[model samples]
Target: MYARPAHFYARILEAPLHFARIPDKAAISHAGRLQREKKTKELKGESDSTSKAKPWVDQDLQDDTEIPSPNQGDDEEDDPGSELDLPHVPYAPPRYAVDSMLERSRDFYTLLNQRRSVRFISPEPVPREVIDNVIRTAGTAPSGAHTEPWTFVVVSDPDTKHAIRTIVEEEEEVNYRQRMGNKWVKDLAKIRTTWVKEYLDVAPYLLLIFKQTYGIGTGGKRKTHYYNEISVSISCGMLLAALQNVGLVTVTSTPLNCGPRLRVILQRPTNEKLLMLLPIGYPSDDATVPDLKRKPLDDIMVHI
Candidate 1:
């Protein structure tokens, strides 16, 4: 076999070392450029992207540093593990319990069962403190991954209520005339719903429920939340029960036009998705609800 020249062997020995140095040199140069850009932005009174980008880059750098070189031998002294030190944390089980009272539960269920979908509400003003207390009760609901993703906005100002009513009526008019076909109108015929939303303005308070689709953690990273819709719905149920328990009447209004309009009117953050708008107040002195009956327990329940 023919042997390579002495210069060829020299080139082989130097190539690996040069290739290894190239990555380190590139990393250092990139770090320097990032620092320079950060400084330039600071001097110009502009926010630097470095602070926002550093965590990701730093993590990558750390991963790269942990990787052993291809030429490293088993006998060579290993790098110290100080960079990868993880503190020992003691394990502690969660300590929380729910107190169940059968009697109270029975009464609560009974009260909720009496709640009717009131449409003809009185203009009597509901106390602000009552609404606040109801919201506090709702905050105790079990939520997805313990992320209490719900917001209740209580609007009481007459002008704001009037504005909401106008916007809602405009949308409802279009819905009744054009959007909602005859079959849809027929289905709602017995319920007696109208395009004119006088209740929006007449009600003492409009409770807007928002469901947080995602939570913003520290540094604005989105944290995943579980059962966001179910959690919000559960909380809303508890809120309605609490409101009824306090002797205040409420109507769960679902004007198809209200969701988008309320989103614009409230200027809510994008993370918060609108759920439903509830008009809450006292019923009129002579207010009357439809004489409707609910399905029997046997019909709704199945014993498996």
Candidate 2:
């Protein structure tokens, strides 16, 4: 039997960058029944636990389901002028020899294979310029309609970091006690994670990534940022690779019920929504990671 940690179950509320555990069928069935019962009570006004709406949900929308488009209420005359009017330029990047290409690919794979999600981080200061260059590399990711809709907020101030930590911990505590069900709590017992996030303060830098849902165009018209989520996700992948290349360590976290408050505290405009939070620094001397294995190529790849 596994002992459930209330705080450990909070990850289910916000979601994670990666899901390393799969709950058993019996557990899933139990959780489904519980959710159904809760919904029934809520419908009958017999429970007030969720009397108010969750901050993350867009309450204005019906059923709190649709994410409002930026161009939804714009007048027909509010034309967002064409952004691709500029002339295209010809360019060619260097092409390597066949042998060199194979060697480089193998070396890159080896480097990335060693990358791990390290929670223990050192307080040693790192060069700011290195971080700048890594972000620059991430900015080169392809975007839909060339609308590069992403913002990276880097926080280093001790006070500000503490404030962010407080908010995350408070929300996490509430979610664990009131929101999470038993299935998720039991599933997370293997890795032993809790709501307490000391690394938010211990890491030298906190990188918060946001995705811009829309862009402001000429005459203050709103322009649709197509596939903004996918574009930002690609950039995040490049960012992780860049950090690994520079021998830095970080763990990706998506804190549930904490986005709106974090955005307000950071003073980001309403157009932006938080996507990921990463605490980055050198690994601590005694840092450890679970012994895990990647799936074989045969299991992951589908050959034609």
Candidate 3:
């Protein structure tokens, strides 16, 4: 005569709830039949879901049960494997339009060839804007690894240019007297180069080109650059061509002891190596160059 909980009494009144005394053998048989029915229903549901999700089967398997094909719409004729056998279209060629200004290439070459180093420059001042444009033009030159490793330092201050000239002349004097020796001097004689660097001060701008030996990374580690010499030379050539193209005269002047003295004078880092010192400005009225001749095309060219 124990009282049941409220939930237990309510569940007993439900129509689905039934209790009966049965033998152990009959109870076991009823449980086994129920479990078999539940498992069969679960397996059927899984197979149906898998078939709906993945209709395409592996090539090794054949579809035993036939199904209606999807391309049954009869407005137009259709091939069963048309989607899988679509043709691939090739890419079209790029369009290359000729530039109108390209006609001046020959004239530009002639103008550049006429440009010569004027040891004697006029004291006329050049516009800073012009120098900026020239440098920008030089930046367009192709470089090794596209790392345009060059620095153009323009010194327009009279005092700074004068000081630089003094340092350069001192080095040049040593080079001509002691370093270059007689043979080198004789070879340079035809060009009429000397230790007197008066053009450095007279020119409106002194562009000192420096080549970076290597780039500094994090933690002060150095990364070696490829084709540093060739890259710097090409950049210098582009700069010279740009200056000449804009109707400005330029003289490429290289002085000895440039690496040490100029670095100290310019207060540059050790990675920056001095390559060429260009004195750029208008030439004097009496400026002249040697009558030098270039090799003919036939002599310079070879064909296989």
Candidate 4:
């Protein structure tokens, strides 16, 4: 019924001509889930000041998702009728040969492959400047409509870390004992994670990434931030990579039911929601990670 199905699949598996011509079942399912999540956030009035468009962008409509073109006419709302608006300058990024690009990618992958999320971390003091640099690197991540929607609360003081650890442990204990069902707990058994998060205070810094649901404009009025989740997620990825590049280790930790308490502790505004907590420092002397293999590329990629 099919013309050379086996040969077609073999060519797709071996060759590299077709980079992204087919969408697998997982891609479709993920897109659908993203669409639903975007809907839920909108219902909660967590909208951006820009276009009230769907949070999820279809592959074909990816360009449309961007609110403004880089060179689009003057958006300086203050002077609506000003004819002296300056146009955007030409972008002149350096071009690299394909071989050099591939080599750099491979080198990066090799470096990052050594990174592991370790629970045991050192209590040695990290310089405040290092923290500032890492968070600043995260801020450079791209965001929707250029509305960089992320706040990093760098907690270094011993007293504050202890307070955060207390609240986090309190909430986690309840989750492990009551909230987390058997299946969920069992699934976590392989990674050897528990409710006792002693590293929260052990690490030199606890960076909390908060997603700004909206912005405060002039006169304290509410303004929307676009694609908040996407923006914050990109920032977090950059945060981890920046930390790793500087020879620091970190574990991505999330505390449930502790957001309200944390907000009070950090004195954050109402529009910000805590998205992730990262404990950053040097790994303990006996730090170890599970010996695991990554999914093969052929399994994840497809061809036309």
Cα lDDT, all candidates: 0.68, 0.76, 0.65, 0.70
**Model 1 weakest 10-residue run by lDDT:** 11-20
lDDT of 3 by residue, 65-138 (tens): 21223422222212212222333446687554566345566678788778887777888988999999988887
**Model 1 spans with C-alpha error above 4 angstroms:** 1-105, 179-193
Clashes of each: 1, 0, 0, 1
TM-score, structure 3 vs. true: 0.62
> What TM-score do all the candidates reach, one by one?
0.62, 0.73, 0.62, 0.69
As for lDDT, the candidate ahead, 2 or 4, is 2
RMSD for all candidates, in order, please: 21.8, 15.6, 32.2, 15.1
Q: Candidate 4: where are CA atoms >4 Å away?
A: 1-86, 179-193
- Number of clashing residue pairs, candidate 2: 0
Q: Which residue pairs come into collision in candidate 2?
A: none
- Number of the predicted model whose lDDT against the real structure is largest: 2
Give the per-residue lDDT digits (tens) of candidate 4, residues 185-217.
Answer: 555554235777889889988988888765555
